[model samples]
Target: MRITPRPPETVAPADIDLFDPERFRSGDQHGAWRTLRETAPVWWHERAGQSGFWCVTRYAECERVLKDYRNFSSEHGTILASVGAPDPAGGATISLMDPPRHTALRTQAMRSFSHTVVRNRTPRVTARVAALVDRLGEGEQDLAELARSLPMAVTGELMGIEEQYWDRLAHWSAVGLTPEDPAFAVGASTAATLSTSHHEIFACFMEIIAHKRANPGDDLISALIALAPGGRPMDDGTLLLNCYSFMAGANSTTPHVINHTVLALAERPDLWRSVAADETLVPALVEEGARWTSTPYHLVRRAVNDVVLAGVPIAAGDWVCAWLPSANRDESVFADPYEFSLRTLPSPHLGFGAGPHYCIGAPLSRMALGVFFRELVRRFDGVDITAPPQHLYSNWINGFSSVPVRARRRPAVASSMPAAREGACAHGTS
Candidate 1:
């Protein structure tokens, strides 16, 4: 008689070490996302001790939910419900806010983030990327150290936060994003992490705000300081809220684009080779890498009214999350969804989000990554992954925590030596 092996106990995507934060931080969990994206395009998941939610796993549906924000409002919490500390100062969750109000604030921000401003910074951003890569010396370097720093430096410049405050800002951002970890919530022998960091960092923003008020400049801080809508100055509450929003937006997303793009290209020699052959391919690489990077995995939305999605009923007050990363890999929308292809055109990935609330800094982030990666492949002779890339301690943002790389290139080689650089590798980032 033949006895079959026992099947492993199936775990829900919401529960499958997905929220442990540490697992993602350490790079242990993988592949359930692919399974979810395929089998349960939009499935309901239940978590122990907290409210469950509908996980939207396909690109077609994810785009629908994100673009039609009116039907699926995001004004509540953006992801899973917290059995932990909620933001103490929470008035409106900016990321989750519905439009009209969201539109007003976003418009104010667009004035500072317009296309020309980002284009002007490209050279400086390219210089930073070059210097950082040149410093690598073909040895194992923490991708986080270089990748994380570039975005923080840019945020520091944009926010007037100063270099001395950069590390502290990074710390708060990690804590602020990673709530299930020991950082955010207060408990026995500890105070709420958000409370502690909010007071300290918000105070720092206060100084910047005050300084800009007295002596304005071309930076975002000064622009926000001087901006008044409808002939009334923005109140202190809205002002602080907008400032904090910018910090959360830029610092969280930009670094991920850089870290994951490099990791993705290093893992897939073909795309790297394309960039090596033609630096112009950098833009496509940037788009596809970011498309694959999968930041803001799910944009959770509250049902604004009774709505039907793909014939499924969504009751008002119910929470639904659009699984964008899963969507990007949807086999329906993509051909051989898991493979990295820089040549794929008319690509429709939801990494920067979609519709009215689509990320305002997208053009900036895209240009920066394209230039950075182009310069890297152009300069380095050999770029290889030395160790498995690690991911951050959050479920909301799908990005690398660490990507160990060994990029080989003759330091003194001619600037235009080879038409292509990536020779051997495997994997994708967006």
Candidate 2:
């Protein structure tokens, strides 16, 4: 089942409601985003009985808002759900805090995701992805399941989270992000589902933190426990909130990028064949995949003071959202932005975002994607979609909940190639 790309719609600013998850589900939102980018770059999005927000769609404007942390505060919230109210995790978690404090905590957190650490872990990640890819049998398989497992495995190991808790944490992370989706909803109301999932994750992390305190290890939690920023240790609440932030950030986004990329390849078999013939193209393929997916679709920030963006006046205390997918597709920044081609080297897409809040896990994410796709094309001739992807019903996360596919396993003779044999055995011995 080849999924046809949705064409952009000619929508007026008044018809656009960035808060509606349904539009994203139907792919109509792409048209709306396109319209907003071309016509109203800085749009005041208003809906009945809900607070309005300044939606910045163009690349230049979105980059400006995200980088200008002093003028726009994240403490209020980083998603539309917290509009008109301060985020509960505000000031405690890295994503929700502004600079000085955010700077200190992020600096400490960076220790876990440093380039050296990620590079050292590459062989292990490659091995893990290879094993997972190898498990896919030839008939039909849900690529989403494979996509979901890799991140949890890599991130859980880094945090020293026990394997027994990985599955539940992955589920809770999904639920916490998209409580409105019936597939992930745990309770009657969206609020209840969100609360339940968050509570479960927090409780689970508390248990892990307790264990780490008694028996420290070389992991993120243990590192944070030992950290003394500015001569003061991070409090329990802040520590716990950061743990949640780390897990959610790791588990939620990367999997979707995997799904979207695989699905894109499935749709374009010619591209898949090209990638299969050349191993070196994998890196560019990974970059193109990240740019095309733009999984963490939009990030919300509140204005600290009155500001002018794109000739539009945004009042102090107003909500401002930077649509990453739109910015990535901005014609000015990317040539033929919508085309999923490997030619765009050094992609300037805001897939990981920009400035102070750029994703810390980006290196790990790129490594995982590169390994997965490189191994995937080598092990399988190609993949065929068996059903249309079921996209998550959320404005925040742009991903599929299910992508049913049938793998075409490569012939055994193909494994005789030196590159194929090398990739198969590339897993590091730890």
Candidate 3:
């Protein structure tokens, strides 16, 4: 989608500048969003120079926005920064397209992520997780380092990226998502860093695409290239955008979920012990973590026509954002919304979102998380959080760049030396 200059619409009430990145940086947005969900389900945020947008904070309203794409259309953009951008990849990309087009494009990519595909790929995921666990040191280490690196390497394998290029891919993805974070910056300024990273990412994909065209493989890149959607080969630009989307979608959110999962478990050794005892609970715990973390906080959409959401009038051509964190924490939907628990299995979490634009990598993400956590339990009895988690500086994404922790490998007291001695004595006597 090309960036287009949009005329300022009628000003929304200045209750809060939801666009203010500082709210997220300070980690105060959750409280603010919770309050809005109760008091004002549909709140408007006006940026000083930029046009204001409506925020749907309630679960019902957010779901309505997601499902009613006819009114709340992604044709404009699905991300805050891309709205009104001339080249939003509206028609070409699955994410930015509406019903008919979106359905078709999504179908093309959906096959690669089907139940069978993910099921067949489980062994690879398990091996990857086990290898990662093997590399963990005995004492204090940054859990976030493993959290950040492991997902990228696994996702890189899925995308057919060379092992050597995994770090570069992670760096580009980090800069792309959190350009505001100085740690991710490539140059002196965030803007320059984002620009350089985006250009490099696109250039790298161009080389990959060229190579894939020459030599087809089992990778997603080759699969997309081989596909003739509507009996015509997809254009190179659209293909490149899809490649970027896959990388961003797969690499950005999962690490945060993993980090948050580790932190949550570390806080409750009882819960950790339970998971270590029964590996079957790992999948449920993974879902709960995704809900609790709300990694992908919100997704943006534009109003196709004037519509009232939860009694709030949204004008045609206005922007609408669905705050996933607020929805995930909706009291009406989730019992004890703020409290995280494995019992909240099969949660209707909006972490992957809802409706047509739901995350395509949901299955893969779940598989990867389950494998990681199960392997974690096998290797470590528990985690000891070493320091406070450092969150990423974006309102769009609820993620942490660093969460320090130590992986403790000792078996529980119940199953340690005494039990081992008894077993040895029994075996010798027998």
lDDT of 3 by residue, 1-430 (tens): 1111111122234435567667676544665676677678898776677777788888999899999989988877777776556345776777778887778778867777777888877666666665666455447776666767766656665566667667777777888889887667777887888889889888888888898899887778888888776788888998898888888887678888888777777767788889878988888898888887786778888997989888888899888889887798888998877666786467788888889988888998898888788777766778667777777788777777777777777555423333224433543311
lDDT of 2 by residue, 206-282 (tens): 99999999999878899888887678888888788888989989887899988888888877888998998997899
Worst 10 residues of 1 by lDDT: 421-430
C-alpha TM-score for every candidate? 0.83, 0.94, 0.89
The runs of at least 3 residues in candidate 2 whose Cα sits more than 4 Å from the true structure, single-residue gaps closed, are 1-7, 413-430
Number of clashes in every candidate structure? Answer: 15, 0, 12
Q: Best candidate per lDDT, number?
A: 2
**In candidate 1, what are the lDDT values of residues 199-230, reduced to their tens digit?**
76687777778877888877777776677654
Looking at model 1, residue 244 earns an lDDT score of 77
The ten-residue window of minimal lDDT in model 3 covers: 1-10
Report the candidate with higher TM-score, 1 versus 2. 2
